[model samples]
Target: MKENIALFLAILYLIYRYKTYKNVNKIIEDRIENVHRSFFKRIQDVLQCSKEDAEKVGLALDKYFVPLKSKFYKIDNNTYSFVDEGGFKGSFSIDQNYNLLTLEYNGVDLLALH
Candidate 1:
């Protein structure tokens, strides 16, 4: 009976862990999707261009920007940096609402990011 109880508890713990893992993955997915959407919207608004054009620009920018969410994280919240293979470095910040507040590439201000 003691062995059965231990096995049951282990099973319960595994289920709990699986659920927690799924929740964490979902949260990450949602955050990434939100960032991409916000970036896309900003690109369209700034360029005053069609959806296709905005998408192309956004996709290209993603090469530099997505790393902010994936890697090169700073201890400071909402700030991230990216360095390309060519040694071009960039930084950007996100607001509480997931909006891009600022973007700088190689010391050049890419956008006002209001």
Candidate 2:
């Protein structure tokens, strides 16, 4: 009857919504992983350090450079400058390939450090 059809349609809608939500979450996770990898690579290259060292620095920096809590300004299409209330300041840029092109802290250029 019409009541049965309505119930079936509602179930289908719920299933569709669940799948969409799952897919969105997966995309966000992948993007976060990518960012982490890119940051580690940049740190390693700039600091001329090993993976372990880069990871250590990255973890420490994360405490101050959190994007959500920092005040940020868009510098260009793929670049942004940020300052945390605690006095940490930096800028970063990512290329189309998700490679980090630039990273700086407190007016010191990471790429030119060593």
- Please name the candidate that would achieve the greatest lDDT relative to the true structure: 2
TM-score of each: 0.38, 0.37
lDDT of each: 0.64, 0.68
lDDT (tens digit, per residue) of candidate 1 on 4-102: 999999999999999999999999889758876666666565455566665665565575454323223352576666565666777776655445566
Model 1 bad stretches (over 4 Å): 1-71
lDDT of the structure predicted as candidate 2:
0.68
- Tens digit per residue, CA lDDT, model 2, 12-43: 99999999999999998897577776776665
Clashing pairs in 1: none
